[model samples]
Target: MIRRMTDTALSEENASLKARLAETEAALEEAVEAQRRLESIVGELQREKFAARSEKLDPEQFNLPLEDVELAQGVLEAAQERARRALKGDGATGPRAPARNRGHLPKHLPRIERVIAPESTLCPCGCGEMTRIGEDTSERLDIVPAQFRVLVTRRPRYACRRCSGAVVQAYAPEHVVPGGLPTEALIAQVIVSKFGDHLPFYRQAEIYARQGLALDRATLGSWVGRACFHLRPIVAQMRENLKAADRVFMDETRAPVLSPGRKRTKTGYFWSVVADDRGHGGTGPPVVMVHYAPGRGAAHALRFLEGYRGRFVQCDGYSAYDKLTAVERPEGAWQLVHCWTHVRRRFVKRLETDGSPIAEQILHRIADLYAVEKAVRGQPPATRLAARREHAAPIIAALRPWLEAQLSRIPRSSKLAEDIRYTLGLWPGLIRFLEDGQLELDTNPVENQIRRIALTRKNALFAGHEVGAENWAMLASLIATCKMSDVNPVDYIAQTLRSLLDGHPKSRIEALMPWQFRDPSSLAA
Candidate 1:
């Protein structure tokens, strides 16, 4: 009996030892994993601080262990809080800080004051006639949800008593879309929501459905098409105005158009031309016009700028723009003004990628030139010209030789070498800014306008057809121009369409342009 009892006890002890061993092994595995994760987080943090900032950099460099970092941080904070609680020994909640007040609503907003009075005039103790007292006041902001309403029109005909055959009735006001259910204001809202707000038609249709309105995407698209048809003349005038400027900035961004009979999108381009002399102190108002083209070929650019009388055309080093000076036209060929920002960007990339000291030196020199430009910004052309001559010319003269010397040292295939060669090739155009004060240091202004196109592209993904792309360009041009001029796009589109339907003459269309537009209320005041 004693031998059997000893065997059973030994077996039980062995099983318990095995269970404890398994628990310890599992814990060891977890600790190893935690250590690996912490090391990964540390490495990523180091790379992020010291490595190149470009998104094009190695993907592995940015694959940070974010979740592990968060978990570790939480564990540490909890441990620290527990230690503090143990030290305190009294576990009562601490007093909280008062909440910060948000500022009051704008004074310009219309206020609808509502007064709340006591239930009875007499005091609570039943005293005779409660004395007049000051009242407490508080303001809360409120909004009335957008509601669509149908405008009912009534016209009655009257016949003369003596001559019943002759009848007369008041004529109905013309609609932007004759016999269409949408009002001018509603159409304007659709256009603004689509272009300015980047809300796609299908999404807009869904939103309307939520409001108990069963408007289809196709119907909204049709409205956009018709609106573009009517607004084409104004866009054409804007183009004329833009090209008439002595100097204009130009850029192009890709626009995808859906291919018919195929389940794919074809690449297109939106060629943006911007006129803003405010940078160099010229008196012209800023205006931007975008043209949609099936391709990014030089032919499209040439055709777009065919009647342009501008002497100086500023753009990047795209091969297409080479034809700007190569092609012949009624007006003299354009003088190409290359962007210094492009040149600076090349060196910046080289410095970031290759860690080249030479590229860093070049960037600093370019920065000096920009510093001079910054001081002269918004000054008259003559003043800017003088400032460049005084400060910028010396840097350019010094940079040319240094660039040439570095070209000989670096490998011909290297990015740094390629950048140097490009800058040398466009040396004359890059220096032209020093000669003309009206010219900007870069084509950044037009590029800024192109960003809006990118946002719309991201939301809509692609245009349905070529015509849809054209309509996109037209509406974006008007809306962007309105924003540049600080004119409210909603008000501008609604009022402009109303005036057009009211038979406003084409001769007076220039006045309808965003910069030239005037509010009737302002005139009355």
Candidate 2:
């Protein structure tokens, strides 16, 4: 009996040991899962933090007309849908819409309807008589026909009575040549076609040849080069005045060129500097300028900012800005405001490819900041500053502690963790906007300018040469600035060309700015 009782006790102990062993293994698994989740949360927080710091305010700072934004949004949605379909393997996504061929006459053109009227007059009590008026007449009053005209100038010479040798013809309005076929207006049209329309001179030559004009591309190029030369002073004035502003945005993109010493594959960089003077209730001038260089370096930007004395310059976190000192700056600029959107993009990139819980939290926080911005949008800068202080300050202040606490918990290998650490390092510069009313939350305006150039480059592929690239910078600068000011680019370019040809001085060029030229009364209404 004693032996059997001892065996039973041993069996019970073995069963208990098995149960405890299983429980311990399950607990260890749970601990590992908890660590994984914790790592994810930290990652998400860092992502949000980085994105929040990189956020830019320039693009959304201005109120775009709803019609324009809506139109762009429609295109975007359609493109997105197309992308979805393409992802499903249907076909190419967002290919350019086929050009509508309107040159052909309608297959069944409508004809004018013929009217019939009774020729007999009404019958009277005693007799019926037939009376005819003039034959029924039908005429089309609004008859618009395709009309063309050519101006023929006949310069008649008059001989002096006393001195027959002295003869004179009407001076050609200081614009036309006695024998030249191209007028100032015609030259302006060609200028618009070449620079404004991006039609290379060689291509334009073919287009003209098709119309029986027989103009050489080289000659056409020379004419355009001369036109730009004539307008150089105006461009200079625009640049000088624009850089003089207290705040500016800068962006750069590749501008391929065919350098004489280099192979055809060599390329250059086109740097775009954009500024909006309408920020202070339309009291400021809108300036968009471009500078071309063979490289992407601080020296090119340094030249552009040569005489600029401004308080704030909003730009992406290009390392070049770090090299500038108060003495080096023409304006003795104090600070470089980095963009949060850039920082956010880095974290967003990681999130899309790797699911990091920490990145998600940071995104949430950024969304919160945007929500606050949405509420205060279009308010006066002072009001916006105030709203940010009241609403956004606390959120930012609360984020610091979380960032610090989470940074300690994340592993070094995680990409999200490194992003968080980098953003935290730049905390002072990123959050500097809370102290100043003039600063923007992001560098989106400059980014918008960059995006435009990017799109153009994507379409055209590359610039023909360095000089051609420079012209691209100049023309794009003016065109984009005009667009920002809500002025039709074609109208501004045409008017400026006319005014310049009419002996308009360079100093008064500000009169051509979009916002200034736009009827102020329309703004009032």
Candidate 3:
């Protein structure tokens, strides 16, 4: 009886040990999963902050429009031109090196041929006048520094001798500014120089003065105002076209506006609405419409997007955007897709400030995502979706638990913890791109448009008034659209003004849109 009782106790203990072992194995599996998930999510968090390598904006390297490197190149070219002119003026014509692949001049520039016949057209052997032969041609670029000449218009009144007062002078040629001094071409040059070339009106006035013309800053501004009045319809048309797109990119930057009584410049804002189908392999031409507002309030942004027909909008995770998605609207609610670049930027700052290993890890992983994005760019949506599913899905899946685990490891109250939480909060929107290949991984395209506006704001210093700010917005929109459509802002504006002055039907303004512009030469290289 004693032996059997002892055997029963031993059996019970062995069974208990086996059950405990199984429980431990299960716990170990869970821990392993958590570790992997933590890494994956952390990587995503970092990537969301840093964005892609190509999209990285370094002010030192790429201040854009006004980049230091470009400025240096211009200075060097000017100096080279001066030296060449001096050497030529000295009249020391020497033998030139034999030409080898040297006749590649731009086809657009007008060529002026100058023949340099041999001294007496006589042969070295005293043979009378050498027989005519084929000539060797060479090209040298030359510039006629903007010669300002007045266009004199004479309207002669000729009353018929045999009939009633029939005074006519072939209706004075049309001008962008009726009865105004500056012609459409001149106005176009001012607009291009100011916005496209980033020259302020005062600087332009100085440049004109150098050309022996008296154009004050105020006079220039008036011309711009007159042109702006005529361009209102076109700007409105551009807005309608942009809003009609199925997907649009939205971004904003601050501008300085002169205050009436504050004795200081008041802050204003510029919003850019971009519709670029080329990045996604869509056939429609890309366009951008710039809008100016007095403040950076949600109201301004919402108003910018008011009556927006597009269902998908890509933008930064600004609080103003909170009012966008899941809200009632005329066209129902639209989906708000967050920008991974904005998210990645935060971690980039973190990594720069303190070499956080987790931040580094996340940035590297995000780079992986960008690599996938770059390869699939300009490809069909189905291809992008397949690539993301095959590659990005596994990374994101592994990221979740890893991110959660890292959160536990770090100090609960630290900024790292905070960043991770912020990233996790936006996890749904960030990961939403995994299914939709139509969406971009970031807002780089639209952000790029904002750079031009930034250049204007950075240089122009400030707008004189709210009206002036509006003009900047209007003109900048046209210039930005012209660039996207491959049309030269100066040529397009000049021709469009002529068309308007010649009475282009208001109802047919669509024909004047940048992409619809008729003259191919007006398109820039």
Candidate 4:
């Protein structure tokens, strides 16, 4: 009997230990899974930090893979919550960090204040009265939804007492669109909303419908077309002013237009030309013009630049610009200056893809050149030319031979070889900045303007027709120029349309340009 009791106790102990072992194994698996998730989060954070922004530069570079990071963070929080519950025996709450305050809102924004007062002015202790003291105030930003209102115009008519046949009355104001119901302010708002804010007409129509205004997309389209028609003369004047500059920056971006009777959209182009003398301190206002074309061809560029009297045109390494080299005009022959940014981008891509030390070295040298340019920016052209010759020329001289030697070592089919050849081929144009202070190192100004078009294209998808694309270009040019001038685009468009309808002379229309615009108050004074 003693042997039987001892064996039974040993078996019960063995079974209890096995249960504990299985529980421990499950805990271990949970901990290991948590550790794996944390490790993945760290790896992704590292990649996100080090990756190139442009996919063309490094196709492998990820653009902020936040979904995985968020998932890992959630898992970590859940595990911590479980651990807290186990330790505290339930009803335990996790502590949260207090939210940090963002900076105060701008004082320039108009504020609407509401006062909250006590139910009784008497003190809580039953004092007879409480004297007013300084009150604490807090501000919260609020917005008022846009509302549409009808503008009624009534011109009273009178007749002479003796001669009833002869009648006289006040002349009615001219409308931008004859018989159109929308006012100039409303038209300006529509244009600004579409091109400046990238809101499509269909979406804008839906928003209006929600506000109890039944505006059709076709009506909005018609309004935009008419506005562009009225604004075309202004754009034409802008182009004339842009072409008259000594140097100009030109670039192009694709704009797809929907073809009638087809489901597919045809690719169009917006050729942008920008003139800014601020870089070299010339005495001319900065302006930009975008010309729409059904195709991206050399002929479009040639036609747009037909009457341009500019000495130098800065552009990328596109062969379409090569056609401009053949033009022999009496005013002046166009000098095509290649962008250093384009050349540097080639090496930048190679560095991102292959980790080439040679590419990095080239980039360093180019950066040094840019540093010199920065120091000379806003100085006279003569000063800029002198600075480049002194600081930038020697670097270029050294870089050319190094690049050629590196090129010979690389395989003919390699990207590095292509980049080296491109730089060498455009070497003359790249160095032209040394000759004239008026020339920019790159066509970045025009490229910057093109980005706004890209945003609009991304939102609208494609223009409804070729004419619609032309209308888009016209309005965008004015809006972009207004932005550049720091003028309120809506106010400028509204006032200018009213002035144009008021029979403002075409000869004096330059006064209405964004750079030259004056407030109605100032104009009246």
Model 3: per-residue Cα lDDT over 165-267, one tens digit each: 6876678876666787888889999998998878999999999899888889999988988899888888898888887888888999888999999889999
Best-matching candidate per TM-score: 3
* Residue pairs clashing, model 4: none
Model-by-model lDDT, in order? Answer: 0.85, 0.69, 0.83, 0.85
lDDT (0-100) at residue 17 of candidate 2?
97
**Candidate 4 residue spans exceeding 4 A from truth:** 1-108, 123-127, 159-168, 520-525
Worst 10 residues of 4 by lDDT: 52-61
| Candidate 1: residue 16 lDDT (0-100) | 99
Pairs clashing in candidate 1? none
C-alpha-based local distance difference test score of model 4: 0.85
- The digit string of per-residue lDDT tens for model 2 on 43-117 reads 668765553333345665456556688899999999997788878777444565444543343433444667776
**Error of model 1, residue 25, in angstroms:** 37
| Number of the candidate with higher lDDT, 1 or 2 | 1
What lDDT score goes with residue 398 in model 4? Answer: 94
The residue-by-residue lDDT of candidate 1 on 281-335, one tens digit each, is: 7778789989999999999988777777889889999988988887666677788
Tell me each candidate's RMSD, in Å, in order: 13.3, 13.0, 13.6, 14.5
> Candidate 2, 514: how far from true, in Å?
5.5
| Per-candidate total of colliding backbone pairs | 0, 25, 14, 0
Per-model TM-score on C-alpha atoms: 0.76, 0.66, 0.80, 0.77
Tell me the tens digit of each residue's lDDT in model 4 across 418-445. 9899999998899998888888888888
